[model samples]
Target: MSKYFAVLLLLIFSTQIQALEKVTLQLKWTHQFQFAGYYMAKEKGFYQEEGLDVIIVPADPNNPNVDFRVLYGQAQFGVFHSGLLKQRLEGKPFVALAALLQSSPYCWMVKAQSGIYVPRDFQGKRISLLGHTENGELLMMLQRAGVNTDSMLLYSGKKPFDDFIAGKFDAMQVYSTNEPYQAQQLGVATREICPKQFGLNVYADVLFTTEAMLRDRPQQVMRFRRASLKGWRYAMLHLEESLAVTKANYATHKSLAQLAYEAEKLKDFIRVSGIPIGKMSAAKWLWIAQLYHLDVSQFHEHKADFIYSEVKQDPASLSWVLIIAAVLTLVCIPMYIQLIFSRKNKSHLR
Candidate 1:
């Protein structure tokens, strides 16, 4: 009995090890508190609880494209921005899982001394911004404000914030949760022209995977999404521990104060009053797609598939269980009848 028990223990351990699914998550940028949920998921063993061995890959100079990595299968999952919607419209076969940030964090930052106060003020000024697809909210804000985006001088800079400070560019794009804090630390007084002011709301830090992954491994996707959301909830609720874990392990470059500032600012975007964390509303998505000028028919056709839903158990497996149960019942009925008749015969003999 002891030997058999030992064998059983070994088997259980081996089975658990085998059951762990090894997966990779490609991050949008370098390690920071922006990706706290993912870090917490891995750190707090939430991923492990879901039978996942997740490798959180941070963006570096070489590996910067999260979407390319995920779509090409280099990474099983990725965290990206609403820019992913345009790619999906272009037939990229991408699926958005959750929007960690319910509101857009992207904004154009200018020194307080700079006369640029609004999107309209950006006209005829040197601006550092990404492509229209990448920073559509900003562009849309400019357009809505009656600024001809094409007429404005735009360029991408390697050190945009520094350039803005040096008076090279009138304004540079920044994240409300991140760069504002950095500028504050550097003693630079800055003002942000956020898109939300113009009612152009976009989601950031979106978790997503490919359609192929969703279709082929729905259960894995469901488990990963569930665990990731759980991590997000925990991280939001336990900001101090999340900051400590991130500083000590993941983003050492950022000080605790800096992480805390980011955490505090992001709470407004992450935890809305009525909305659930990581919940993506279909109405908001349709509005975003409309902003991109995508085909309404196409958006409608792919809408259901693009948005994620819970994966149900396979019907084939359920049918197999029923078949086995029916067979067992059929086999037992005969034995039960024979036993009753045998007992009756024995009574007669008595």
Candidate 2:
């Protein structure tokens, strides 16, 4: 009897241990303070506490295609640019889980004394950007300012800012956190031209997952977001602790000073004055789609409950009066008949 009881207990323990659902997350770029929230969540046992065994994977620096990892079965979730909407517009089944960076940190950079102070100055200049993000917004800024790109020379490649500092180009696209710090270290004075200054709103660093994941495992999805946001809040409040956790576990080439600088600089990028973290408005998504000129006619989506969350939506009071179509047609028919009789009277008089 004792031996049978021991064997049954062992089988139950093994089954409970195996019950934890495993998922992998792919990061957009190489590991750094940029991904500190995820690192904090992992190190602080938040994922484990949620009954998740998350495997965090960093992209190869040479190949930083993050969305495809989530789109395929290679990974269930990823942090990527809001430009993922372009793929979503194409009918791909990717659902945005959260907005990591409320504001985009991308801008055009040049030497401080390069005499290029405004978006208009980018006309007839050579420019290169690292990623596909914000490229459309940049062009729209120039176009709105009456700056022509016909004389513009563009290059799509990696690390163009180094070439920018070498005087191989007039201006290069840079993230406010990374390149400006590098230029400062190299004694290159760079003046960053921000898109927000030109009336462009961009969303960056979006967290997304597959439709299958969200649809099948909604409870786990909510758990992941809750824990991840908790991790982000802790990281922002405890910068040094988060950085220490990240650096100790993750491999990166950046020095301690560089990582620390990124941690401090990224706070502004992620935090808004009054908005909650991970909050996204449908207006923002629609504005981005408009900026990119994406045709979303097929989406047939609405603004209500646009973002996925566990919070119950408060019922909206009837703000709009429903106008009956039959009543509208009845009101217009008299005008239509009068116009036809008036035209007939004019014809008779002629």
Candidate 3:
């Protein structure tokens, strides 16, 4: 009787272990309240309930990009922004399982005391951005307001708000949830201008995988999405607990108070559109496509047309700029040649 009972326990344990499906999810950035829902999901055993052994991977700047990790099978899924959707339209093999935020938290932040009240005020001003991520939205806002694109200057330096805080620039682009809150905490009065003001609001924070994954492992994809969305709903209702989980697992530079502030801001962004959390719409994708001036008709059949939008570069006058650059390079050739020769001669003499 004792031997039979021991065998039953071992069998039960092995069955439980075998039931859990192992998978990895790559976050778009470091661990913080930004990923509170995922943490809460794990903490609550939502993934386990779905028979998934979900591994949450934080993004490391020193490592390959999150998209590459997912593509190379290091991770089965990843969290990215609307930019991924745009890339998909432009020929990436990615497919989004969820739009984490109904509308983007992306917007332009400007010091209100600097006498710039609106998008029109951005003319001839230095606006710090996160690479070209939000440039399309900015240009669209400026164009709609008749602001001259040439007069505007964009600075894409890392941790961009440092200069802006010191009053070194006219305005800076930031997520509605993050930098604006930082500015407020530091007592810098600011205003935000979003794409929605000009009818160009796009979705943000997508959980995605490759098209091949959807083709080959559709059930797994569905299970992951359902589990993640469920986790988000639970996190939304239990903000403090979810945040505590985030703080415990992923050390953040932010104070609990600051994270709380972000939590509130995130809640607003997630539910602002009155859509269910993790929902996407065809109209929103269509709007972003129009912002980039892509062919909307071609959007009909591509998964992109149904799933996302085509984001392209701005149509500013590149020809004249290229011509001037070529002329300048031609004139600088002799100087460059002399400098190179001088450096080489100096090295040899030494």
Which digits, one per residue and each the tens of the lDDT, describe model 1 over residues 125-222?
Answer: 88886743556788789888898888888768777777777788788887787878878988999999998877887888899999999989887898
Q: Is candidate 1 or candidate 3 better by lDDT?
A: 1
Instruction: Give the TM-scores of the predictions, in the order they appear.
Output: 0.84, 0.80, 0.79
Taking the tens digit of each residue's C-alpha lDDT, what string does model 3 give over 91-174? Answer: 778887778876666788887877777778777788775454534676677778888876667676665788889877777777
Cα-based lDDT at residue 310, candidate 3 = 22
| Tens digits of lDDT, candidate 2, 1-350 | 35544655565545445655798989988888888888888789887666678888989867776788888879988888867777776767777778888877777888988889998888888887445654567667788899887668877655576677878888777777788899989988878887777778677778888778877777777777777888888888889888787777884577788888887777887888887877887778888777777765533362232345564431211111122233335545765787799899999999
TM-score of model 1 (CA atoms): 0.84
**Model 1 C-alpha lDDT versus the unseen true structure:** 0.84
Clashes of each: 0, 0, 0
- Sorting all predicted structures by lDDT, with the top scorer first, yields 1, 2, 3
Predicted structure with the largest TM-score when compared to the true one = 1
- Top candidate, metric lDDT: 1
Report the Cα RMSD per candidate: 6.7, 22.5, 24.6
